[model samples]
Target chain A: MLAHYGYKDGSGDYFIIIDTDKCDGCGKCVEACAYGVMELIEDEFDIEDGSMAAVTEEHRKKIKYSCGPCKPISGERKLPCVLACSPKAISHSW
Target chain B: MITAGVDVGAKYVKVVLLEDGRKVLKRANGIVGFDILKSATEVFEKALLEAGLNHDRISRVTATGMGRKAIHKKHPLNAGEIVPEVIADAKGAYHLLPAVKTIIDVGAEEGRGVKVGEGGKVKDFVINERCAAGAGTFIETMARALEVGVEDMGPLALKATKAIPMNAQCCVFAESEVVTLIHSKVTKEDISKAIHDAMAGRIASMVLRIGVEKEVVLIGGVARNPGFLPPLKKELNTEITIPEHPQYVGAFGASLLAFETEGK
Candidate 1:
């Protein structure tokens, strides 16, 4: 089933990278990702996403949800949950 | 038997004097003070004088809400300040409406979802202290952004034939959207209605999450809005009872708690 969707390794060595320093944890990326691969984690940073950020299993840090198919509330480039981050803690490269 | 309740809210201080369990005198004032005890004392004294009753005639006193903790620690105050206040709010509503089971208190800065049981006791409650979406401030902010008086919002919203889609999910961002709509020359009535819809939508989402019971009572400052009722009542799909003195609900409930304390 995973192979049929054709998950590509994009731009980075890791499948996903989350900067815990920047995540706000509004959980939009988790809601957006169909694969259920990302989890919002609590980190002590206000500048990233204001409250919580998404962290992947691999622990690599990235910024915002770049998923093309996700429906953002504001039609924002980043999901409102990820855009809400002040520290820039969520990103998925693959 | 004169019992009193002082609801020191974020925007206003409401004091109520109940004479033999009926409201004899009530007052709401917007005062400035860092020391709540002074304000409480001032308001209490004012209510007492207005009712032509001295402090000695008053049986009990109760306090509720965010300022409760502060009032409890102040001079000549007791621990029963907060709990009785909540109980009184529920009790007062019970006296007016025998069938009331749920109380929605949307105040200036926060909102509360209260469920009342037999004998006017609060069964379970949820306080939305972390978010400002359900509070009066949300509408106030939207009113400012839309360039209309908050008091005029309900009537203006009622006149709206269509509602524009507001983009922001949060209160702060939503206010910005209202400002942008104004720049786009959207009708004020439509903007007002949109604001009402947004607020009602947010509160409705919360109410739906908790599962509202029949005979729900809507109270606090936001309950006064005519625009708020239609959408909220539609969402509730039940008859909502709004007391004549809604803003004083927490204070009224506190007074009832005082009566309960005295077993009167």
Candidate 2:
């Protein structure tokens, strides 16, 4: 858990991966982090309730810092942002 | 023993008159002209009167800042003909805050940093004259967003809640972002803190890159912004020294230069 908050790799080295199919394109990812690493992009994701929702201009996909990538998110220890995400649009690399 | 330094910055002209390292008087105004020399001379004369001195009593006059070259033409001092504005600021800060190793100066359209050695010499420095984010405009835009005067920002920001991240890299986009955040009901403190955080992060990165030393000092007009100091200090993990008159350091540096030259 401690490692989760602190970046593992050298500063400016870690990268964040997003699953577009699973991503609902909400901005919780960007809000959870203080570094302004992620941004909301426009994309679509199918929900579990057998409904297809499209992310319009009202919605956005989250991208990382412009200068570099975000930390690597994995299964056992998913991205902190993904865990804090309320819209359930994100998951770690399994 | 009486000397004067004039700094005609992009947004304001500063005049600092010193007597043997003791500051006699200082004045600043937001004035510009096609003939930067005339504008500087006029401001200098006004400052002289304020200090109970005359042009003839000023043994040497040194010029520093973007308008320094133009100001130099008005004064007939060969040794004081050309000097970088940042260098003059470093010299002034070295006199007032002798232990200061890192100096940050935020002007209207630019920001400057100086890393000085123990012997009052510049070790290294960085400048950001090209970006509005590094200057006072960042807070000015925030002031517009909050519907408050720029002078009120310091106290107003202290009342804000959690900081809402302001992600825009440029000033225009950042303003747009603040408007959106405001519309979303983000508290003013959060927005203000976010703005300060973003700029502080930028400054921290630069300061770290430059290898900052202990006893850092923040100067320039924006240094008056109350909320900027706490966040900047926290982010940099350093104590910052700011004078009662932070905005006059450049002119003070310029004045100190004049005094040094006159003594020689």
Candidate 3:
């Protein structure tokens, strides 16, 4: 299951997309996220039945502001949460 | 040339007037209530008046903080540009202490840790996630609960006899925990220290992400708290530097940017 969290604002669509299939729930992204945007939650459709990381509900509506500090207004994308995910399960829609 | 910077913080709006990009002519602070744009304008006009200057003397104006957009929207003619608070903080801190490599800023609604690179640029930064537990709002709430003045919490906390650990991770949960502490006869001093320590721990964790560097400067409203500083220093195992007017760093930095980017 691909979990998408975030909303489109006046700027554009800002989303943190996580591919649960590729995510092994190592919690690295949770640890790497400084804004506390992501948290470890129980994976409902997991074959192995383990926990996976997902964006916290409180930040869903304001991802643009919550994750604003990490995302530079200019320059290439190098998000810590995405980089910390070893399985490459995380991507940003900016 | 004279320039101005307006920082419309959640709790307070700060305005700084700078002359020739170096000397601070005047600074003003105003509480931000329902009208952020009005607060911003009031502070800016106050600063200019204090400096014995008029609006026409200001060559440029830069706005920052959460309410920067509103200031720009209303005063398009006055606010020439808007910059992020993180970049403004880094620039202001670096100007004060050139050796500052790490900057921790705790505001009313949020907290940020900025790692400064060469030329005082923000290399990397981290902001407190979703909760206000690690920010000044938590401390203010605890102070109100304890019936102590917010400004007095810092000095009173310094008188703690013993450390009491607050286990609540969320600000909402921490409020109940504080009430429980009060019922348990925990002294306000001890409770204050516990709150500062807990908030410091969260800030330390955020700073640890980019790694702590020497000459760490703590800015923003929380930096004024004496009790918070000791715990944050202890938590990070580092000596912290605080500028003269820590709360105005963002505005000061914005003013510096105004000086740099004017007419360009």
Candidate 4:
């Protein structure tokens, strides 16, 4: 399941897309995050006791603000999270 | 068919079981301590026990609230179908009063204003997760500062002879201000009113960002505060409607969705 966590309001789309198929529950993104936005959640089926990476509940409602600091003002918007993920499961929808 | 909705809120967990999507079987809630799933299951089991039913009797169980995401496979509550608390709150409030087009839900940790369209669908919402001053925790902290029960904060405010202005909106600063008020011999009642007024201002501003519509309803645990209601009503400049069980609205909405999502 490709879970998109974020809301679209009068502001443009701000989403942190997580591809569960590609994500192997690696905690790299969780470690790389400075804002504690990402968390490791256990999978529903308990397949091999694998977990999945998801945005924390507190940050979900306000993705733009939560993920804003990492997205720089003028520099190359090379986000630490997308760079940290080996499986390339995480992507931001600006 | 029986369906259940479990709401794992920030400060509390709630469970509501519904029969055939219309009739209610039980409502249970308790303080949500550490291990969010454990407390939720305890409350769920309590509701099950009260209803005289087994876990297997519930055909579908949908989970909602701040801690809804915390429900993983290890959860013994058989929680399924993760739904956002905003949606559940909207659905639940709309069910109770179909005319309610706007819902203001201020839980212990967060506050939100949900605009509802036809059939209780969420049209738009503004969530105040960035600030604790806009939530029930603000009063909870102030109540502790005043050395009064949280339940007494509201009623105590009602006795105030004059409205005392609270300078600090942040919970941290507000606590210090309460300490200062104590030193200055400020009555607890006036200070309580100041706390509630500041809290209401923050919440009402959030609702205003979405613009208030007619038939507004207030839900969540804070709705039970008799002192907080008047300030909120005055801030919104409108009459606020509250359900008999305001805190149960989220669970009620989730159960209604459980019934709706039974086959799908």
Candidate 5:
């Protein structure tokens, strides 16, 4: 399942895409995110499988501004949270 | 040397003028409106006027906050540099309380937990800008719904006779919850306490992530609310320091930085 975090506004679509199927919920992203943008929660899709990493509920509405500091203004730089995810489950749609 | 710092916050613009980076000569705050540039300039000029100084007297000016970029762009000649709000807050709080190792600043649109290292450098930090529920906006909205003055929320909440939990995680949902509580005949005091407690819970979670150290200082305009303070202290299980003119801490720090940069 592609668990998407963020919203579309008049400016553009800002999303923190996480592939729940690949996320092992190791919580490395949570530790790497200095802005409290991500958190680990019980996997609702895979209830019996324990937990998974997801973008925090509060951060879903304003991902562009919330993730602004970490995101490069121009060139593509690997985000700390995405890099911390060993399973390569994280991506950003800016 | 006289230096100035301007903090263009989401809801307000704060300016602090310092003499030789040690003593605050004047400070002014103005509500931010449609024109952030105007408001920033207004507050900065006001501070300078109050200090009986002119623009020529200011050796340097540093700007910080959400609208800092705008200030920097508009007055590139006047605004010497721009600093991050978190860094400004940490610097300001550490200046007031030298022993402070942690800073928890709750502003109109954001809440931040900053862990400070020696020399007031930021070691690590966490910000909650994405949620209105954990910020001052939540309290302002709930206070309006309850028909209580914002300044009176703290004292009224102190009289809360019951502990009513506020479960709504979003501000929009929380507003509806407040309406329901009002309809259910719940006392406004209890509702206010519940709202503050909810915000405290969120702030505590962020602070915990940063690992609170001793001498925790709370800054920002929200630090003035007495209702939020007790619950926040209780949630963190530690004493908190609130400096005089808590809201201007960021600007004060920026002024100090201006002085330092000028000296360098």
Candidate 6:
């Protein structure tokens, strides 16, 4: 399942899409996130039947605001969360 | 074989019975109070009695909803599998309307927007977490402020003549705003419309984040509200379909799954 966190308003769609199928529940993304945006959760949707990385409920509500500093609009930099995930399951829709 | 789906929702418990895995047999629901199991058993019993069957005859049971995990295994409501609400909702809507690709479920506590793929697969989904403004409770709370019954709010809102802006995005602040409107002599009808408008706006925004698709279906208890449809239709700019007994769609979907997965 593609779980979209965050919302869309007058500006545009600001969401963090987490593909649970590709995510392996590794804690790498959890530690790499400076804002504590990601966490390992037991994903019931995954066919593999194991935990996976998901955006915390707190960050999901205000994702654009919580991830404001690291947004690509500011400057080009390696996003620690995305970079740490070897499975490449995370992507941002701006 | 007969299968049952138990949807233990926050405000109510819904049960759906299916015969030979595909045909709808009976659907029953009731207000859920302090005892979750008791409420579930009563509703389940009502459905069985209506079908002229006994509890032991059910071959399998699948459960879903906010309170699904809370059900004990020793109880009669014990389900072989506990599926999440989104998957159950998507499956249920798609089964009822195979063409439906987008499903919006607005219950008492939360609202969800699900994007479905072929074969009732869940492609993408969004949930309004920890917020009352996007759910049916928003209307229920506003009804209290206007001294109207929950059922009356919808009809009252249709009588609104002017568009009133309610700026509060949170439920707590919205209540105070409703009180202020009342003190200012604003009619209850207009205030009710504003409440529905605000709620539809929030639900629409969440859905847009994932994108809306054609053949949209609206399920859950709030779909029964007469006032919520107009504003929601205007916001998403698309016609929405509501399945028969929309509140039981989730449970119905689970029953379908129980039948399909019988031998697995």
Ten-residue segment with the worst summed lDDT in candidate 6 chain B?
B69-78
TM-score to true structure, per model: 0.71, 0.72, 0.75, 0.74, 0.76, 0.75
Candidate 3 chain A weakest ten by summed lDDT: A68-77
Query: Candidate 2, what DockQ?
Result: 0.04
lDDT, candidate 4, at A1 = 82
Please give, for residues B1-264, the per-residue lDDT of candidate 1 as tens digits: 767777878777777777666755655444527887677777777777777777787777777756666777466544245653346567768877888888888888877667778877788765555456557888898888877788999999999999676645557878778878888888999998888877776566555534578779988888999999887788667788899889888787777677667764
lDDT by residue (B113-148, candidate 3, tens digit) is: 899998899999877644677689999988888889
User: Comparing to the true complex, what docking class would candidate 5 get?
Assistant: incorrect
- The candidate maximizing TM-score is 5
Kindly give the stretch of ten consecutive residues in candidate 2 chain A with the minimal lDDT sum. Answer: A1-10
Per-candidate DockQ versus the true complex?
0.04, 0.04, 0.07, 0.02, 0.07, 0.03
TM-score of chain B of each: 0.91, 0.92, 0.97, 0.97, 0.98, 0.97
Q: Write the per-residue lDDT of candidate 4 for residues B223-258, one digit (tens) a residue.
A: 999988999899889989989899999999999998
Clashing pairs in 3: A35-B129
On a 0 to 1 TM-score scale, where does candidate 6 land against the true structure? 0.75
Higher-lDDT candidate among 2 and 4?
A: 4
Superior candidate under lDDT, 2 versus 6: 6
In Å, residue B224's CA in model 4 sits off its true spot by 0.2
Q: Which candidate leads the pack in lDDT?
A: 5
